[model samples]
Target: MQHLRVAWALAGAAAGFFLLFLIQAHLFGEGQLVAGTCEIVTLDRDSSQPRRTIARQTARCACRKGQIAGTTRASPACVDAQIVRSRQWCEMMPCLDDEGCDLLVNRTGWTCAQPGGRVKTTTVS
Candidate 1:
């Protein structure tokens, strides 16, 4: 009976630790980070090949209200006023090796997908 009790206690503690880990990921995952690169590629629009990169700007965190991780928003994420940077990524067709680039949330942003439709990160910016 004592051995069984010890086993149960250990199991319970492990479960508790796993639960906390999940909660932390939800509240402060990489998605919540106010950082990402934005690029402007020169797409042929009619071609099914890789596009050329024309312009790129160093971006700053410009998250909207309540976009930060965790329950508390310590400071608002703002962008540089002097620079005109894209708010989202993949503004043009940048997919390579016959991959596809699909826009998200309408035509606001875009992402590269493999032939199997799985998203693959080709470039950070």
Candidate 2:
């Protein structure tokens, strides 16, 4: 009957709307996503003394969803090293200019200092 058809259409519309809301809530909710900071440090090696300090900076880290594809190794996104890990025993490279220095970002998200300042921190996808 006409009335039966109308009722079915209304029910379908309501169900569609409810499903959309649930999906959006799961995707956009803040708690569902994780974000954090990373620091990188660069060290100098050539100095007369054994120990030297170089530069430092911070970057942002976020959690992503995916399964490991091929090997036992985890995805880079999940286990990327911070700056500190890279510089633990590395020597420092000379600065490019007064404001420049040889540096890299560590797993912690910090960069070694350059002549002018530390490298700017940023986020990657």
Candidate 3:
């Protein structure tokens, strides 16, 4: 019947639109950019010579997925996102009430210090 044909056509159009929406979302979903502060170290380069450190600088950066603002041994820089995630703590709120959390030097781990003089240290594996 004519009504049945029109209903089928409408259903097909709706399905097509849904499929298009999904494809668009999949392609653009990971395009988010994150902003952070990073350190920059400038080096003096000479031909046939080792690079020498010139100055340490800081900058605000907008990094895309898979990259993060972090610091290197020599200076602040944009590093792999995984490294940032592994090095960061206290942001995860692992400390309890009446406790203070601090990120360890070199970002090797974190420590939670309680007001009672008890401390818990967690190292990154």
lDDT of 3 by residue, 37-120 (tens): 443334443345444322323445566567765544323456677755776655555567667888999788667788978776
CA lDDT of each prediction against the hidden true structure: 0.45, 0.38, 0.62
- In candidate 3 the C-alpha lDDT for residue 116 amounts to 79
Model 2 agreement with the true structure over 44-116: per-residue lDDT tens digits = 3344544443333232345333321110111122232332234321222222233333333542222335554
Candidate achieving the largest lDDT:
3
TM-score of each: 0.34, 0.32, 0.33
Off by over 4 Å in 1: 34-53, 56-125
| CA RMSD, predictions in order | 14.5, 11.9, 14.1
- Residue 79 of model 2, lDDT score: 34
Ranking by TM-score: 1, 3, 2
| Model 1 TM | 0.34
Per-residue lDDT of candidate 1, residues 12-119 (tens digit) = 999999999999998987644434322222323233446533332233343444342110111122433221144343333345656666546644445677777567
Model 2: how far residue 108 lies from native, Å = 11
Better of 1 and 2 by lDDT: 1
